[model samples]
Target: MTRTARPRHYLMCRPTHFEVSYAINPWMDPSKPVDTDLAVAQWERLHALYGELGHRVDLIDPLPGLPDMVYAANGATVVDGKVLGARFRNAERAAEGPAYLDWFRDQGFTTRDPEHVNEGEGDLLLTAGHVLAGRGFRSVTAGHAEAQEFFGRPVVGLELVDPRFYHLDTALSVLDADRDEIMYYPAAFSPGSRAVLARLFPDALLVDEADAEVFGLNAVSDGLHVILPEAATGLAARLRERGFQPIGMDLSELLKGGGSVKCCTLEIRAAA
Candidate 1:
């Protein structure tokens, strides 16, 4: 069966208020200051690239105190116009949860305030007809259950074993949902989660530790075109061999905050 192509809509927040004020995650170092100007320049180029690719791009106003708000994918997970709001684990990002919820509500989505802590799409990734949720560093098992109930879809809970790969987006990426194809790092996940991945996506592309460390798995794909980090040369080559066009873009500035292409963009899906 031939899959129909749909133009993807993404929600992105400008790095206008971006900075590493505190060290909430392992990747963060408050002592090391961020180059705000360079961050904005790179982000603008990415935004322009999305527009050039014929995808719709939307923006959310960046609030002053929410530095990590630039990682828009953590805002919410929207499936079929129903939004599952994020309940951030850290007090530093807690306020961002409601801010994102309000944006979704204003955009006409039926938003569900999560009872448990989940970092939106950052932890709850959709592939095929299931929601693969990650739990360990940031999200809880309860959030996975809530996602399953809220989306009315099967939620496969995966445990992230590595501290650097705190979010699922950091270790795994769904390349082609229709084909059930994914790219991931096995060591980042628990033994049980790895088994689940093997059973479900046996033909999955596995990235090496070098590529995974560069946030290679944190990519965004429009089925045909993949937007990934330039540093992941090996993964990029594998994508090309698999018949997908891999477009490499440098997001080095955002790497300091533990984010890349996928982190800066949130997919907005239409109702089924």
Candidate 2:
């Protein structure tokens, strides 16, 4: 089957305040130097790339103290215009939850404040058949029930075992939601979750440890085009072999905070 590109609407936050002042994840280190200007420059290129690809990009104002707010994908999960807001597990990012939800509410989207802790799109990913919810790290399993009820879609709970791939978005990328196609790292998930994924997507693209380390699975796709980190050369080739145009980007600066293409870009799947 031939791949096709569809223009998508995205929500992004400029890396104006991007930094890794604290270590919440293994990738982050307080002692490591972060060049704020470089992060913003790289992020600007990403924002421009979306426009060049004919995708609409809308930006959320970055809050001064919220450095991680640049990873807007962690803000909220929007499906069919209904918004399920985030509730961060760590206090470092706790305020980000409400800030992102307020943006959705301000935009006139239907909003629901979550009952349990789930890091928005970080733990919840939408596929054609179901919503893949992540657990065992950042988001709680109970939050899966909340997402299932709100989206009116079957929520398949997957357990993340790796600290580096703490969030679901870090370990998996839904390549084509219409086809329920995905690309993921098997090791980041538990054995049962791996089995679940295999059963659900037998033809899904699997990534190696090298690609997973560079946050290759952290990607954004528009059916035909898969935008991922440039470092994942192997994954890019695999995406091409599977009939998708892979656009490689250098988001190495953002990697210090454990985010990449998908983390910085939040898909706004509005109701048709």
**The best candidate in terms of lDDT:** 2
Model 2, 1-272: lDDT tens per residue? 89999999999999888888888999998898999999999999999999999999998999999999999999999999899999999999999999999999999999999999999899999988899999988999889999998899999999999999999999999998889899899999999999999999999999999999999999999999899999999999988999999999999999999999999998898996
* Candidate 2 residue runs with Cα over 4 Å from true position: none
In order of appearance, the predictions have TM-scores of 0.97, 0.99
lDDT of candidate 1 over 88-205, digit per residue (tens): 9999999999999999899888999999999998998898868999999999999999989988999999999999999999999998887788999999999999999999999999
Against the true structure, candidate 2 has what lDDT? Answer: 0.94
lDDT values for all models: 0.91, 0.94
Quote model 1's TM-score: 0.97
- Please report, as a residue range, the 10-residue window in candidate 2 with the lowest summed lDDT: 15-24
As a whole number from 0 to 100, the lDDT of residue 77 in candidate 2 is 95
Question: lDDT for model 1, on a 0 to 1 scale?
Answer: 0.91
